[model samples]
Target: MTQTVPQTTAGADDIQEIVERILSAAALPPIVQAGHPALRQRAAEFDGQLSRDQLDRLIGIMRQVMHEAPGVGLAAPQLGIPLQLAVLEDQFDVDPEAAALRNRSPLEFLAILNPRYAPLGTGRASFYEGCLSLNGLQAVVARPESVLLEYLTPDGAAEQREFVGWQARIVQHETDHLNGVLYIDRAQLRSLSSNAEYAAHWAEAGISKAREGLGFDAGPAGISLD
Candidate 1:
């Protein structure tokens, strides 16, 4: 399935009520796990579905949840809201050596509303990815190395942007959440591992050992693990 989510419209008042109800239910909403119906349903797009204050609050809360989870990106479906909204940020906390190896750099915080993306080229890269909702498991998932993204800013201005390397992967991952897809759905089943197993058996070798031992091919792509 593609990450093409159809736009949806809801009265601002109605959306405000919904947001308020959900917020009141939890000061910090829990990340909905993999099997939740909300995670399985396609999210409704944002079309002025929030008043300025409500939108601000929602974005603030989303950012808090994302940061607290220590995740690079998070989508509304992960919060059980089923809305096409997401927040992404990365500090490139890794050492310069690792950052360069991953083609990673710092990213400012961004809230993407009703976002979509297209691969920039045929190039792809594979890496282990874990989700806040899935907790404690990681799997090798291959994704486009670069992507062109279209999204609405918090103020509803439409924008197009390009992201590369690790940032591109983050964009694809969160966007997939809005479309009711998880990384595991596109992962190499043989490469699945618990956090402990990954650290104990594959962390030092990067993905090369996992690929060779697990018998999955990452194909020719961006970052070389050889």
Candidate 2:
């Protein structure tokens, strides 16, 4: 069952118009890039901000943009919509060795509203992460390996869930956007690499090799990272 947002006269129409504009194409649209004001501002909490039809339409467009970007997650701010909402999916056909190393697993599509998360423990992992908003570059970011997530479903029901491994990374990344934080803010600056460079060198070498070559320590030693 799909939940529809409550209609508010002028506000509903305004939000619907914005959503329609975003859905004008099925392919890529103008995703907000790094340094954009929208990406730097804290997003507002979503509370029936868009009418049901508009919300559903916006979600569909967002999914298309995310898939077209070939990204694991997307935040509303990336679309220049300052709302605490995001969609995530990680259905990539990962290599077996990489999967084992990162504990990577397939994640079904999910739409989360007003989401917040916190580290479940002190355990952390460092991995190269890229963003749709910051195309062509990736950096090593150390993040908690597990998180306790609290969010509202499209139906407006509250739910708390725990996510681990690569899935946890995706959750934290998306949630950080709502807080006006980017991965680069937490990344090891020396580990930044363009897509071409990463593919030509670091792709086969792994993070440890990347650390040695890039001359950046991820963090305190002995942290069990993949």
| lDDT (CA) per prediction | 0.81, 0.80
- Write down the worst ten-residue block by lDDT for model 1: 217-226
TM-score of 1: 0.88
Which ten residues in a row are the worst by lDDT in model 2? 1-10
lDDT, candidate 1, equals 0.81
RMSD to the true structure for each prediction, in A, is 4.8, 7.3
Quote each prediction's TM-score. Answer: 0.88, 0.87
lDDT of 2 by residue, 1-226 (tens): 2222222222434544556677775556678899876577667778787867767778877898889877989988798777778999999998989988898999999999999888898998999988888989999988889999999987789999999999999998898787677788778889899999999888852599898888998863222211
| lDDT score, candidate 1, position 142 | 86
The positional error of residue 66 in candidate 1, measured at the CA in angstroms, is 0.8
State residue 169's C-alpha deviation in candidate 2, in Å.
0.6
Which residue pairs collide in model 2, if any?
Answer: none
